[model samples]
Target: MARDGSVLGMIEATEFLDIPTTTLADLLGREQVMDIGIRPLWGPVPRIAGPAFTVRCPPGDNLMLHAAIHRAEPGSVVVVESGDLDYALAGGNVCAVAQRRGIAGFVADGLIRDLAEVRDLRFPVYARGIIPIPGTKAAVAPLGEPVRCGGVTVAPGDIVVADEEGVVTVPAAHRTDTLTAARTKLAKEATETLDDWEAAHRSRIDEILARGGFRG
Candidate 1:
């Protein structure tokens, strides 16, 4: 896992953004664990990717997130695992600070608030849902540790790619190979999209129909 001081070990956001999350998830065999339910809250661009700064907060507590926003390296995406739900863990004020500090974005397994204000600030945030009620900040949760968010276990250094579709994480161990394979698959998909359907068929239409038990 990459820590706040270990930016050199993390992949650049540009590389992750180049390949869409759908391509990565598909190449990874539709592994649902690779993706998160979190959707983009707001930004000029609906896409963001960067090394994760994993944080674990108990349900409605967001003290760790507040600390992470200030401590995490610039360009790092703050990933929080909110144990429960029903309260907003982050809001526009914190997002404004994160953006000013050069943070890439935010992803939470819980809820957040200040949707209009967050959009007005042009900051990127992804979370399970939104709520008007804010959470308690009394708890001081751990940061830079491994945690599960959106059904996937994320380490501090894992690469996160998110867009209008959703968020997908690439384990640090698989980052290089994953990106390479996803790029290859994306290229193939592009060609397949343009090639004539008839030219790419492996069998005649009659043979296909016959296999389907159709006499016509």
Candidate 2:
């Protein structure tokens, strides 16, 4: 946990956010990503939310991510970019290392493999999809640069909230504001909005609330 009593890892943060990122995404009017694969052995794809730290890696390369790992800060999630390359930006070994480093999780615009291990370790990871074939087999990327993931522009130190609903970036400069706004939005949701909508328009709301339900 953080010195302030805030939980530092993915699991701890979940209780504070109350709702998972996927659920939050739905609440925020985002679409469900059916394509985001899962680790069959690990059950459902885990959802995680926390402050973010973004990284840009060359397509088919993760050397920069390795470098980023060395520089990672606790309570931070490393968001990487691969232009939807469907490449293996990260997997078991890398995630294992990241866990040891005290990082929260990982978000990638590309692809990943080694399904069971990542989840078994309980380290959250978000990505466009997965592929067992791995990546293009190259390495020439730079670290701490801007990256485009899931149709969003991201930079280093940006905040990232990810879940079954998909991945969303919280720009670095707006980190504090974003967290505050999201928390307020969530607070209002739990108290009144989430249930009201479910009661008001049972039919229409049900369709929109298809996956699970959005509080706000």
Candidate 3:
């Protein structure tokens, strides 16, 4: 599939955005869901869905990520694998440029700086945390390569759907199947009332309890 979201198509990307990461997590399981550590830098962050533009940054050097902001195509989510968290991977201006260039958002396995500026810009950033010191732009690495971020192995062109709840990566090969399943599940859920859900939930819990011979 094209990394530019052409082969995958922007229409599919828009569909992925309609489904929250939580719904994807339920379908893809924990393996596809990013860890809790990588969360939105600010609350009420708008959901972002796009193809993964993977980048690998060595410890104490964020050259690849810095380079990605300029090169990543519009609507691509820049996913980064930072070697360490001691130094920040990106800051305000870099994020600004990315947003200006029409990049969807960022998902980094390390830290970032200038949280206030990023928040003000309303740019979506999911990372470990924020720091004051920035990493050097020295080390070099390839772009669009597979990267391990937040315990999830993100590959280029994978559908990355992220919001305040969490980040979920839908494998490129299974994008269609995943989206279909997710939409089906959501449609079923939409018709279910809370009362109906509670009754089913209670019955399932009671059955499990009975099977375990729990007397409470």
Candidate 4:
């Protein structure tokens, strides 16, 4: 979902650092959560939260993603819609530059190279996997535009929260409401004791099972 420039800037300033993607996942619909294939390349990757700076890279060409690292603002998650995974979209130096520039991390639907260097830098990267071969830097695509990555349509400035669990994108238009709801959920969960949770869980499961007429 798109928002006005003024609101987009405001939303970008709001970070979900303490809120896990799991919490957001619960609050957001299934469509907002990325598929399992898009996972952290290296862990324990610290949770990253920021607005997305979207990019689209044509198959076998990564010029746009390379261009994005330089253009994206600090604390922005560079989300990419890679055309294919046969060639890597980025390498160690590219990740290094992005890290040096204070970019939050990368979420790519394709692949990347230089795992060792990225792991050493502790730069969070959630992608399909790694490849030895790198793609050419020839394709030109718009930066900061809406792109499809990991089965989710990510618009520029959408809030991206990612960690070991997974990646979830909160729409820019719903950022305020989602953040409020997530915080409320977390706070309530914190107050609930494990015993209380177990009791409630047991009761809920038993009710469902009874309705299903389970004999066991």
Candidate 5:
């Protein structure tokens, strides 16, 4: 039997500072990062940041995703655990409805169909693969509960950040502190341009590499 959890209500969009996934990955550093294999299916170099509305579908069935989209608040990202690679849980039509509902985007551990239309619709979607095969809407699964997605645990209200790099999850409890740390790190980096700094430190880098047994 599948289980569902209570929706925690949506985290305010303003709650998410505009921090890039790359910066978040460097700061929190753990399974907080999803596997690199999950790539954007379409949209421009997207930067999606929103509270997670997690849906765990039984393998090959995505009925609960419909519920999740209707139940999710505006600016929420529906994170679905489709549990396999063969079936597409949602595609362009679903995405269009989601977009109208103010969904920030979608992140799925399974597949999605209608690539050209999905891209044409300009919805930001990230998933493991694409297939013409559609998912059946017969399984009863959990929505708003903690679920494993793309190798990380995602809970309702957890902040989801996805970009060209990949998706990263920041636990709801740690988002404020993580955002603060990421901002500080970004501030410091703004002063340290790397282009010439690396060149200037080439000799120092060579010395360290030599000690590590790298022969040039």
Candidate 6:
């Protein structure tokens, strides 16, 4: 199920980071990065950070995922853990519902369908694989509990970031602060001052070295 109202305050958590999920993994101490059998349904985006509104479900079961759509806040990324199985748990229908609910995108450890439709809608979905067959929603995986997915331990409300590099999880406490810093860092790089400096200096680091230091 998706988290709610300061439970994890996912809506608030997303305002913090600037880097892609892979970079967050680097910042998060290289916790674990898993690649599902499938590929990214969408391209990389700078709006890649979001609070982890999670959905854990039985392999091939999708009831809880559907339920999560209603609860997840807009701009939040919904993570669906399907026990690393190659079974389809979601697809275009769910994507449509999630989009209607204003979710940012999807990250599934299992499978999904309707890739073309999802792409046409310009929705983001990362998954293990795509199957023509859909799963039956017969069981529920524990929500708000930590579950291992794609090599990372995803706790409810943890900061989730995803881009072309794939998905990464950041600790909850650091979500707000760390991402804010990253945003600052990204902005400074994007500034005109930095561009002028790089153009003039060509090698900005060499000038810093010339400015000096302790003798070795």
Best by TM-score: 3
Shift of residue 35 alpha carbon in model 4, Å: 0.6
lDDT of 4 by residue, 23-128 (tens): 9998897999999999999988999888889999988998999998998877789999984879999999999999999898999999999999999999999999
Residue 209, candidate 3: how far off, in angstroms? Answer: 1.1
lDDT of every model, 2 decimals: 0.79, 0.61, 0.90, 0.89, 0.81, 0.70
Model 5 whole-model lDDT (C-alpha atoms): 0.81
- lDDT order, best first, reads 3, 4, 5, 1, 6, 2
Clashing pairs in 4: none
Q: Which stretches of candidate 4 lie over 4 Å from their true place?
A: 1-14
Q: Compared with the true structure, what per-residue lDDT tens digits does model 3 show for residues 1-216?
A: 365455355557777878988899988999999999999999899999988889999889999999999888788899999847799999999999999999999999999999999999999999999999999988877887899999999988888999989999999889999999999999999999999999999999999999999978
Local lDDT at 154 for model 6: 79
What candidate 1 gets wrong by more than 4 Å, as runs, is 1-5, 32-36, 43-45, 197-216
lDDT for predicted candidate 1 compared with the true structure: 0.79
lDDT of 3 at 79: 95
Which residue window of length 10 is worst by lDDT in model 1?
1-10
lDDT per residue (tens digit) for residues 1-216 in model 6: 333554346556556444656445555566646554435866543355666777888866788887888877777778877763655777788899888887878877777888888888888887776777877877855556676667677776677777777777777777667777667666765676866877768557666776786233
The alpha-carbon lDDT assigned to residue 5 of candidate 6 equals 51
Cα error, residue 127 of model 5, in Å, equals 0.1
Q: TM-scores of all models?
A: 0.85, 0.67, 0.95, 0.93, 0.86, 0.74
Candidates 2 and 3, the one with greater TM-score: 3
Candidate 1 lDDT score at position 207? 78
| Model 1 residue 89 CA deviation in Å | 0.7
Could you give candidate 2's per-residue lDDT for residues 1-216 as a string of tens digits? 133432343333444344555444544333222234321224365555555566776666666676676767666778776664556777788888888988877877667778778878877777656667555434665655676666666665555666555565545455455456667777776788756867777977777877576765
Give the lowest summed-lDDT range of ten residues in model 5.
1-10
